[model samples]
Target: MDMINGYLEALPEEERTPDPLYRERLDVCETCSRLQNGLCAVCGCFVLYRAGKTSSECPCGLW
Candidate 1:
C-alpha cells in the first residue's frame, strides 16, 4: 500500500477540466468515426495534441 501511495503521489496533477474541444471531438468520432468539423482531422487520437507528441501543424481546428 505504501508503494501504491508513492506511485499515486508521483503522478502529475489531475486536470480539473476536460478539454472541451477534445471531448466534443471524441464524442463525434465515436459516433461519426471522423473528425468533427474536420477538427481532429489527421489525428489518430484526440489526446495526441494534449500529450505534446503530434508532429502535425496546429490541430486546434475546433477553436
Candidate 2:
C-alpha cells in the first residue's frame, strides 16, 4: 500500500485521477471478480495505482 501511495504522490496533478473519480473507479474494481489481492487479474496491475491515474482503464470495461 505504501508503494502505491508513493507512486500516486509522484504523479503530476493533471496526470492523477480526481479523488471522486478515483474512488468511483475503485468502487467498481472492488466488486469485480478479476480483483485479487488488490490487483486486477486480467492486466496484473495494482488496482490502487491503476485507479489513481487518469489514463488508466479497467481491462474488463467496468469503469
Leading candidate by TM-score: 2
Error of 1 at 10 (Å): 16
Off by over 4 Å in 2: none
lDDT of 2 by residue, 1-63 (tens): 898999999999999999999999999998899899997999999999999999988888899
Q: List the residue pairs that clash in candidate 1.
A: none
lDDT of 1 at 59: 47
Off by over 4 Å in 1: 1-18, 33-63
RMSD of each: 9.1, 0.6
lDDT of each: 0.41, 0.93
TM-score of each: 0.26, 0.95
lDDT for position 5 in model 2: 93
Number of clashes recorded per candidate: 0, 0
Give the C-alpha miss distance for residue 27 in model 1, angstroms. Answer: 0.6
Q: For residues 1-63, what per-residue lDDT tens digits would candidate 1 score against the true structure?
A: 354335434545452224464455445444543455433545654433332222223344532
